[model samples]
Target: MVTSPEEMQNEANKKFCVVVGNTVTGICTTSNAPADAKCTATDPGKVTVTSVPSDHLTILGTLSTTNIIMANWSKAMWQSVVNRAIRMLAWGPLGSHFFSAFATVN
Candidate 1:
């Protein structure tokens, strides 16, 4: 007979398998998960989900605007960003008039 305790198990009551700290050892939890999980040195890009009753917010995407005024505000913010980028380019070794040329092209 063989026993493999390393394998993760999510029973009806327990629904999460998460590493506590920097160690490879993990624990199972039945408690509610945080809104955003923490990242560790070993796993810097991913997070561990403690519990999930349902897949409600699995596909969170970009910000969305519904009103006309908010849409215009977004456009204004984007234009400002473009202008700033152009101004920064003007300060580069190219020349001080780079922003003017960029403004004309863009």
Candidate 2:
């Protein structure tokens, strides 16, 4: 569980939640995770599951759909580093330099 997805994105630049589907899908941010289960982050029903901190991620069924969305423990801070990187690239030198030099360094 990530404390703040927004901060993570700005600082780290990666998707906060894996949003796995089919019980557990597309949550392979860490190769250690079951990459074989590359399911999309689609709605996997409305079942409430307990979100486990990365510290407790080793526990079985720790990475559930509902739990991930509604948990208190946060192991790693999530963000949109990948997407932001693409955006920075798309913006070219102009966007990168503009934001880095003038943007608020929160």
Candidate 3:
């Protein structure tokens, strides 16, 4: 999890590329990311998945929906989502970016 602003900035600088299935969809770089991408950082706590049927079903459903959305997305749509994720990571409060990223995709 990210702990500080500097570390967050470093992560942003890593220029990680988004991949969907076998295709490289979008890249996160200092150039393409928003100007305020490194404003703040917060650690998003981890989740432990117990061997529960409900949890398994939830995960499976989420994964299935994600696959469908990703498969239907155009290159530009993927880029827009990626860019929005970067912007949220940069400007939103702490771990809020994660939700923003997925929410935008939906």
Candidate 1 Cα outliers beyond 4 Å, as residue runs:
1-73, 96-99, 104-106
The clash numbers for all candidates, in the given order, read 0, 8, 1
**Each model's TM-score?**
0.23, 0.15, 0.26
Q: Which candidate leads in lDDT?
A: 3
**Candidate 1, position 62, lDDT:** 50
Candidate 3 displacement at residue 89 in angstroms: 0.7
Off by over 4 Å in 3: 1-66, 95-106
Scored against the true structure, residue 89 in model 2 reaches a CA lDDT of 49
The worst-scoring run of ten residues by lDDT in candidate 2 lies at: 97-106
CA displacement after TM-score superposition, residue 29 of candidate 3 (Å): 32
Model 2: how far residue 81 lies from native, Å: 0.4
Best-to-worst order by lDDT is 3, 1, 2
Q: What lDDT tens digits, residue by residue, belong to model 2 across residues 1-106? A: 6668665443432223444442332222322222232323233431123343555333222233357554443433222333454467458665633323211111
Q: How many times do residue backbones clash in model 1? A: 0
